[model samples]
Target: MVYRGPYRVRVEEKDRPVIEHPNDAIVRVTRAAICGSDLHLYHGMMPDTRVGMTFGHEFVGVVDEVGPSVRNVKRGDRVMVPFNVYCGSCFFCARGLFSNCHNVNPNATAVGGIYGYSHTCGGYDGGQSEYVRVPFADVGPSLIPEWMDDDDAVLLTDALATGYFGAQLGDIVEGDVVVVFGAGPVGLYAAKSAWLMGAGRVIVIDHLDYRLEKAASFAHAETYNFAEYDDIVVHMKKITDHLGADVAIDAVGAEADGNLLQHVTATKLKLQGGSPIALNWAIDSVRKGGTISVMGAYGPMFSAVKFGDAMNKGLTLRMNQCPVKRQWPRLFEHVRNGYLKPSDIVTHRIPLEHVAEAYHIFSAKLDGCIKPLIVPSAA
Candidate 1:
């Protein structure tokens, strides 16, 4: 699949990727996911998203070939690749901050390398094709547990891990009231994971009723349609006895709405980095000294966030590109024990040839689409 421009993607035959570095491996991609962050590129919201680039970060595949230096994995190994590309020995990687590794992205001043993201994120080709070249194969890709389902393995690459990390960042205490903004895949996962972290009450806010219903069913959380509430912040305060939630999560990131000016200036006009509405709302709706975990994807540009309110309220802001590989141990346990099933959120599965339609449906929110998986080698 290649990105042509905003709202455009095409599946075309391309040269098969080969192992370029001694630490690299060639993986035959079987399953890949269309992440919500990919929408930023699909909508032209992210900078330097060039045409002809493949856009996928969540994928699982079988190792087709391995470079001479690759040791942990060999040909024919089924592996789940993490979204972040790191050298494993970098300063950040040593501290388990693989997402911020220094040796991967040439533009490392901003962020580490991410597969299939824009040029700002290292310009690596993604795994939405039949084959993908995985660098630092030993540390970045994990062997899929034999009992794990393919659908679940693919999600672990990004969405599920990101959501789990978001909840972990909240530092939730027992009986804490947690509010998550956005009912997309990450939001739902955060809400569900919050329960595992001892959240007493989880509230998911979104405009779509279908997503809200999924939040309730999948996450076992209360739901609210932000459109129905005159003031969502006020509504949250009212429910929290005017003290506000113990933790507020900004899972909606840049494309959040409910603010006309912010929407126009940020999303529509591109004057600012993606809209800061959800982050600001999280700030206003969290209690003093509470925490805010940002799992949403934001562009490299500056966003007009409510730093004053956050400071005045003494909010502990925790955020980062989730270290996908780091979260696997606990997540694997959860999956094995049936604590969570990441694949439950999949609402559409389309062959690679129909990826363009899949993108359109997901972007337009048509047919109650929640998550869409891409089968690159489907017949």
Candidate 2:
């Protein structure tokens, strides 16, 4: 699929990718996902999202070729590639902060390189096509475990890993009450992960009833439709015995709803850098001195956030692009023990040719589309 502009993408024949670096490997994509972040690019929220660029960051594939210097993975090996494109020896990567690697993107002062995220994120073509190049293969591409399903492997590339990282950032204490904003893939996964971290009660907030129901069934957490309450933050406080939740997670970014003025200035008019309503709600709903974990994607521009409230409350705000590979080890254990099934969240498997339709359905939240997979071969 190729991007033309906001709300426009079409399938087109493209040149097959080749190894451009000694450390590179070429993989034939088998399963690629339409991530929530992809919608930002689709809606033209992020700057430098050029036309004709492929947009996908979550994918799993079979290695088809490798440069001479690549020895970790060879032709015919099944691999899961993390979205982050980084050199393992960089100062940041050496310390497990792969998302901030200094050697990947020319503008390394910002977040590190990412696949298909636009020029701001290194402008590498993504895996939405049949083949994609994997830079620094030995460092970022891991062999898919034999027992892992393809759907599970692809989810691990981004969504599931990001959720686990969000929970980890929360520093959840045993029996802590946790509230998660957004019932999207990351939110649901974060709610489930909070349980693993010993959260006594987890609540998910969203306006969509289908997603909230999924939160109840999939994460086994209480669900609240924020639309029903005049003031969601106040309701959250009341439910938490007026102390607020021990931790709050904002999994929604840029295009949050429930605020007309914020939506008009941010999402509609493009006067601000995405909507900050969800972040503000998370800030107001957490207890004093509590932690707020942000796994949502935001532009490099400004938004009207509740910085004063956070500072006065002594809140610890932790956020960053997820280091997908960093969270895989522990996640592997959780999956093996039957505590998580990442594929259960997958609701649709569509051919890449119909990605436009798939995007429309998901962006509109139609028919309970939680997660959608793009199968290139099926095209």
Candidate 3:
């Protein structure tokens, strides 16, 4: 898929990538996901999003070729690539902070290298095509276990890992009440993972009833539509005995609504960074001294957040691009034990040829679309 401009994507023939470095490997993409974050680029929310660029960060594939220095896996190996592109030897990578690797992105001071994100994220082509070039192949691509399902493996590349990371950031203690804003894929996964982290109660907030229903059924959390309440934060305080939740998570970024002026100025008018409604909500809804985990994708620009309120409340704000490869071990165990099924959230399956239609459907929230998988090799 090629980005023609804002709100436009088209599948076009492009030159197959070749190994550019000794650590590179080429993979024949089997499965790829259209992540919600990709919509930022799709809608022109991210900076340096060039035309004719491919947009995808979640994918699983079989290794078709490998550079001489690639020693971990060879041709025909099935692997799931992480979203973050990092060199294993970087200072941050040495500290196990692969997402913050210093050497990967030319714009490393701002953000790390990511697959198919935008020029601000290192300008690497994404995996939306029939094949993708993977750098630092040995460090970033994990071989898919024989017991792992393809759909689950694909989700691990971004969505599941990100959600799990978000939950981890929340630092949920036993019997803690956790509130997650947004009922999207990441939000649902965050709520579900919170239970595993010993959160006694979980509540998910969203404006869409369909997604709220999903939050109930999939995450086993109480659901509330923000539109149904006059003030969702006040309602949250009341539900939590007027003290607010023990932890709050922001899964909806930039495009979050509920504040008309903020949404219009940030999203439509491009005056500020994408809307901060969700982040601000997290700040206001959490109890004093509580934690806030942010997994939402935001632009590099500034947003009008409630930092002062957060400071006064002593809230711990933890956020980062999820290091996809790091969470594989625990997530693998969860899937093997049947505690999670990442593919259960998949609401649509689309061929690469019809990616434009899929994007439109997902962006417009038509047909109850939650997670859409792109089959690149589909006939």
- Which runs in model 1 stand beyond 4 Å of their true positions? 256-271, 301-303
lDDT of 1 at 248: 92
Summarize candidate 3's per-residue lDDT along 275-357 as a digit string, tens digits.
Answer: 77889999999999999999898764455789999999999999988987889899999999999999999999899999999
Which residue pairs clash in candidate 1?
none
Of models 1 and 3, which has the larger lDDT? 1
lDDT of each: 0.90, 0.90, 0.89
Model 1, span 1-379: residue lDDT tens? 9998877789888899987999999999989999888887787666677889998999999999999999999999999999999989988899999999898888657589999998889999998889999999989999999999789999999999999999999999999999999999999999999999999999999999999999999999999999998999999999999999999988988882224654445446655457678899999999999999998987644556899989999999999999999999999999999999999999999888888998889888899999999986546
Model 3 per-residue lDDT at 200: 95
Cα deviation of 335 in candidate 1 (Å)?
0.6
Candidate 2: where is the Cα deviation over 4 Å?
A: 256-271
* Worst 10 contiguous positions by lDDT, candidate 3: 256-265
Model 2, position 263: C-alpha lDDT score: 43
The per-residue C-alpha lDDT of model 1 at residue 351 equals: 89
Off by over 4 Å in 3: 256-271
